[model samples]
Target: MGRWDPDARGRLERAALELFAEQGFADTTVPQITERAGLTTRTFFRYFADKREVLFSGEEELRERFIEIIRTAPADLTPVQLIRHGLEAAAETIFQPLLEYLRTWRAIVGSDGALRERALRKQELTIEAVLTVLRERGTDEPAAEMIAKLSNLVLQTAVGRWVAQPVAERPLVAFVEEVFEQLRSTVAGEPVHR
Candidate 1:
């Protein structure tokens, strides 16, 4: 393969996911992934540290975008509101295009214990990224951390529903908003257990 293969990273990511799904993550190998992607193992290592990293290749970009959008969000919005805005931007730019991938990714990660742990680490990274932006916006440390974590909770809940439905049912942004509202009501002492 040429050294300058375009989108080698994406190809590797797709290949890795396919292999992980077909053979199970524990059974998949770096050489197998590289072979599936039609690239050398050297090219695979250039894009990712390992097979696990392939599933999370988008997180770094998503983190940066979340931080950027949150930082530039309207100054008057509360930290939670800012987070919602950031998540809205993410839904439009990040999650929307990858809804199907999100479902598959969730299943792949959930199916493996190690992957689930790594996925939690990714979630922590996302929370830290959000807190960074919120703190830069002058939110108190506790408030920033709380808002960031809460925002992630709402996002997680909403995304679960979002990917299960047909895209035509509702946009991810709308699902996020509805989930946040439900979260607010539940936290306000509304009987949510029923």
Candidate 2:
């Protein structure tokens, strides 16, 4: 592969994840990632600000997708239903194909305090974006905030389970629906089915 090769960003991401997994996040460097990808240091910088950006570069796009999902959801849906709809859509469209990448990214982020904090910050920004969209759609502030937080929980839990499951055992959307069902059961004072 050369710098002009297709999927330079994808190559860099894969190379970074491999290096991070083998050498640890703190031990990985831009030159090593670029070398592993058969890309130049300049090509790596073209796609990311730093090595960390390789892991988190999709967050802004994800936030935008979430906002779009909320903005376009059916007006008749209750707050919880609207959130569920958005989360399921995101799971199918944004996360389902990235299970392996996300599992690797999650492990690398978890091993480093700063990376974990960065991931949390990105999640918070996404939640804030969803909250704003919900409020714009006329949900009350308190309800919007709660729904935003709950949606994050559902997304994280669903993605966690989806990544942990054997490939083809279940779709990410199923996990999202399951978590929502559990949330509904908990709120209704019914026994959650685990």
Instruction: List the global CA lDDT of all models.
Output: 0.85, 0.88
- Clash totals for all candidate models: 0, 0
Q: Which pairs, if any, clash in model 2? A: none
What's the TM-score of every candidate structure?
0.92, 0.90
**Cα displacement (Å) at residue 28, model 2:** 1.1
| lDDT (Cα, tens digit) per residue for candidate 2, span 74-107 | 9989988898889888888888887788888888
Q: Which candidate ranks first by lDDT, i.e. highest?
A: 2
Report the poorest 10 consecutive residues by lDDT, candidate 2. Answer: 1-10
The Cα error of candidate 1 at residue 141, in Å, is: 1.9
| Tens-digit lDDT string for candidate 1 (8-117) | 98899998888888888899999999998899999988888888889988888877877788888899997667778878887888788887788888888989989899
- The true-structure Cα RMSD of candidate 2 reads 2.1
